[model samples]
Target: MKFGNDRNSSRFRLPPSTAYRQAMRYDDKTLVVVGGSSGLGLATARAFTAGGGRVVIGGRSVERLEQAREVLGDAARTAVIDTGDTASVTRFFEAIEPIDYLFTPAASYTIAPFDHPDEAALASPFDGKFWGQVRCVRAAAPKLARDGAVVLMSGAASARPPKGAALYAAANGAVEAFGRGLAVDLAPVRVNVIAPGTIDGDLWRRRPAQVRAAAFAGQAAGSLVGRPGSEDEIAQAVLFLLTNGFTTGATLFADGGYSLR
Candidate 1:
């Protein structure tokens, strides 16, 4: 929560240059957060707005978009897009101009035992998280600025998925793989993925208070940091992928070293 010098962090420090400076500051830059209605996506959209960037937030919910706009003030813009649907994806991009940075933190995963998975449960995660991002990238590719960069959201589950996430794991894995391949096809337009570990993201907030507390505690015990990741922690990594000019086709882990365990 410190919001310290995230740009100069030891892991992704960049050399001083005009482009580097502009990339770091976001002034006059057009940054889009596809799932910016709430949670980590909104967190990142706020970060960019704070850095003097022009922000347009897209999501499936209108109420959340209004809330985000209220939180972001006049610096933010809003759009509704359900990345799971191809038509929604195409229409969303058509209404927007070229973008300098595109961040897709929109994701939904269904946790279920593979033994008795329902059809909707099996497809919902991929529909939103995996194909959602894929649809966004493909739709926006032609509209991305020459120096544009993209950051896709993957999860630690792709690497060390647990027992109850057979389909979710495959979806995350596909996202990472798609990012790597797209980096080649896109040529200079940078494409990178971030695989976050167990974080207390908004998805968990709807649970009862006691259930939330116990779940967080259990997650904390498994991390190298002895706690779950904060939303700001993941936002820092997202900014790194957005600004670091040299980073492409890379999958950075901000999972508190949980995968190693």
Candidate 2:
């Protein structure tokens, strides 16, 4: 089902009053989603667009960006950008004027034991995923409109700290810290972080089936709900944060109790 633009139609229609309220809630708002070509980012873009916001999706791959644009249809805009590069980040932000919402799911990580971690393997993530968010937030702050909100992505690794995932854990930890600090600094702009657990999606599609299954099993074992999360679930959390004006400096976990166990 589609929302916002008339190019697509929704399967379910709301009562006239409810539909009017929903439209008034998000009509004409502009959302910028970095790394929005796939996975959680793409899901978030769809949620915002469905709520009547004009969404702009940014990513490093032109092909993926075009694919995303196709999926989002006319209500969405696309931009090619590498968030790691300061110049590219600058240009992307400059091109958009007075954005009402910004969401970044841009990150990279290396899984390795701390003792023998490859310095080279860490460089890209350290620069792109960790500092990439920093640079994007820095560039986006001035352009964000009053009452605007920014949601950054972190992960369960930041809190879980499993073996052979030292680098990923650290990077996520840094991201959480960045969100906390930025929330204070970007007052009235409503900055927050979403720390999602083992969500069942295509992010690990390249891995072997057995590997994926075992990972899912492990997540089920740890989660109180005994299951992995879905991309749609995480996307809903993003929507909650974006719409809830009172929420800021918060780390909303969509982990299905993975962090508890």
Candidate 3:
């Protein structure tokens, strides 16, 4: 099941003037994207940069950060960060003073039977992915502008739990809940989560080509659109959430209808 682009089917749109304005919107604004080295994070950074936003990307890998900076061009900034470390999180935030948007697409996962879950595997996902976002927000909240927004990544697992995904499912669920709670607490500084499902991105490269193709086929069989989602599709959704002032405490699903299955 190959994920195809469907630009004509997009649910959101900006008028030519608005788009032109947005294309020049980032002249003075700054955006910090944690985990922006790849996948949805990288896509989101690209979208923001295209609209003239200055983006600072943070991740655990220096090589990946440099690579992302090269890909994102001169407007893109890079920082070394370990979400699991509170001090690192503080240092990363302190380095970037005024931020207009904080997007965190960082997360880890462990798959195992609940009867015999690995403790080490569970620690990273919970501490790094789950708690990492939480701490980042807490640290950045004070500096976030009144109109600023914090976008966190959740997944379809939060809504549609699969077999052998106990740890991941629970962690995603917590992310969803955290977004809602943070929205109320952070008021006016909008908070939201993107719960994408089976999106076509580099994250799946770990699987063999044939195995991944088969999994995508399974996704298409269950999807309302009959295919997995592309990186741009998810990027569009993230852009909408970032721009829509009326929406907050929401979970936008870009899962190609897999949650409906």
Best by lDDT: 1
Q: Against the true structure, candidate 3 has what lDDT?
A: 0.82
Span of 10 residues, lowest total lDDT, candidate 1: 15-24
- For residues 1-261, write the lDDT of model 2, one tens digit per residue: 844655334645545864654554467899899989998999888877777779999999999999999999999999987877899999999998798988999765556566765677755456757888888989999998889999988888788866777777888888888888898998889998898988887686667999889888988998888888998789888878877899998888888784453
lDDT-superior candidate, 2 or 3: 2
What's the lDDT for residue 151 in model 1? 93
Candidate 1 per-residue lDDT, tens place, 54-87, comes to: 8889998899899989999998989999887889
The best-first sequence of candidates by lDDT reads 1, 2, 3
> Which pairs clash inside model 2?
none
Superposition error at 109 for model 1 (Å): 4.0
Off by over 4 Å in 2: 1-25, 259-261
Error of 1 at 223 (Å): 1.3
Using lDDT as the measure, name the better of candidate 1 and candidate 2.
1
